[model samples]
Target: MMRVLAIGDIHGGLKALVQLLNKLEIKDGDTLIFMGDYVDGWSESAQVIQFLIELSEKINCIFIKGNHDVWCEEWLRDGSVDMTWYIHGGKETMESYSGFSKEDKQKHLAFFENLKMYHLDNKNRLFLHAGFTSMHGVEKEVFQTTLYFDRTLWEMALTMDKSIERDSELFPKRLTHYHEIYIGHTPTTNFGVEKPMNATNVWNVDTGAAFKGKLTAMDVETKSFWQSDNLPCLYPNEKGRNKD
Candidate 1:
């Protein structure tokens, strides 16, 4: 009965993201679940983060760390590592907060570090930044790295034996254990290529907001989806290489 509005990768598309949220007109009892990658790619990383932080005060918001977030964390921790992050739109994120005080930087870092890996809703739904892997014991032994980088589980999910009870009381697969699993990362194209079985237990919302795709969001209870057309990249992909 919890109406959760789950948004996919924002990739710093602040305008598009804002429009999408405005369209939703979030109300009380509705939760906003961000699947991470809040910074990088687009031109308004800092603004987007600031907006989401403020929005969190009004609504029930849960943030899950994505790969880009991990990189941002590292960049903030070490000022000298800017080059390593700039390539993947990190420069824009830094530029967004170029005039911020040292205190501001510390606050942002704390927010990033505090992101949760996953959220479970009364055993009916699961929200995670990335898919899980068997090596990590599905829902039992979750690691920070696995939550952000585990693609192997996505591959295995495709081959899940249909004969087994999807929601079996015993061997509970992550997806099967919950009524539905919401995830971001492993682009839809990758999911199509890796999972040809048409697995329906999991839902992938990451529409490649940073690439030549769209920014997407899904209404958990309604199962309705919304998207915004791809935005122009601030820097050419080639020129922004993180060679540091």
Candidate 2:
């Protein structure tokens, strides 16, 4: 069977991420799928991206764009988006690369732009940065925006009525076409916490690593999971509280 590792939101916790990856004991053929939120929150965004770039050279790595990643792209393309991004822990990401040159920043921006919205593996599983709703079609989907910042879709999916057929053409049911979906963005309990829940075939793995909660990882094929100890939060008030 293929060994697939589904990791939760990193939120710039490079140290913890490295530790978790080490603990998993990744092998040559193993696939490492990062759910989203790779940067912002902790002070290692640059390091995290660099590490992923290096890892990409060795293994099959899938990086999906998270909301913060989208913000980063916006800030890079147009500086006007900095205010919103800064409020959402973008300051930390910026601070992480204080020493990098303009060229280095541009390189990272290109990497962010290249992130995928979703990954389909042999029709059995799907990996997305954030959950998708029926309102979104595959053709119109934008990885930087829809996959990362669409909270309206998330809420609709979360509060969906169970009595209705999940396969309906409206709401998040459109996602049912895929066997299983692994997503990040909405924290399970709160920031830094990890909870695994199954809605139809959708699986949420955000686990909130930015808010002093644990970073989570799951073996999709084996149904095994791993989590780090609670790490400290960068912005205690915002990251500590649950938005939902």
Candidate 3:
């Protein structure tokens, strides 16, 4: 069977991504969904993007755009620099590409510029880099950017009031739109969760590869998961946004 595999934020941990992909033993026919943040935090941002581009040639790939990716596109394509991005790991991403040629850089720019904000499958499952405010579907252009930044959707799941009727207006539409929702912007480590977490049918797969933690990949059908070791261990000499 061609199982759907969803991966968390990579943050440019090429080694970790490789290790997790090995564990998944992914086949050419399988569909793979990556939750973005592919550049930044780690020291191999350029390598990570290169590997992903190659992998897309072998299997079906769905790439979601993260906030960090937005920062990357701005800097790489428009030569725009925002201090906010620099404060968050953009420096490392730039460093990773410092030696690449203009042609090499353009390839990566094309990849990021074409990333999707949200994706829905025939199974009625939704996948995005962050939260969404509308339940009607991704087509309801209600502050569409929320699909890449909103956290209230996950927060509500973590704090669901079971007393409220599901059919009532008081119920959050964000939680009822799809049969399942997968996201990756908010790190699971922030909530002390070290693995893929499912709350109110929303699955948070970002196990914090950007920080001093592991990278996660999950089978959306079987819920089976694979992970890499603490990424700091994977790259001893390079700092991966875990300066603290």
How do the residues 40-68 of candidate 1 rate in per-residue lDDT, one tens digit apiece? 87777777877888888889999998988
> Which residue pairs come into collision in candidate 2?
134-171, 192-208, 192-213, 192-214
**Model 2: ten consecutive residues of lowest lDDT:** 235-244
Q: Model 3: per-residue lDDT, tens digit, 1-244?
A: 8889999999989999999999889876799999979988888999999999999988899999998898999898878988988978888888889789999989999999999998999999989988876667666848867878888888988888768766789877766678888999899999998899988788999999999879999999999999999899998987788766
The lDDT, on a scale of 0 to 1, for candidate 2 is 0.74
RMSD of 3: 1.5
Model 1 superposed RMSD (Cα): 4.3
Model 2's C-alpha root-mean-square deviation from the true structure amounts to 3.8
Clashes of each: 1, 4, 0
**lDDT against the true structure, each candidate:** 0.72, 0.74, 0.88
- TM-score of each model, in listed order: 0.82, 0.83, 0.95
CA lDDT for candidate 3: 0.88
Clashes of 2: 4
Task: Give the alpha carbon lDDT tens digit for every residue of 115-176 in model 2.
Answer: 88878888568788875545344435654456666655556556777776765655364565
Ranking by TM-score: 3, 2, 1
Q: Candidate 2: lDDT of 168? A: 62
Off by over 4 Å in 1: 80-84, 135-139, 159-174, 189-198, 233-244
Taking all chains together, the TM-score of candidate 2 against the true structure is: 0.83
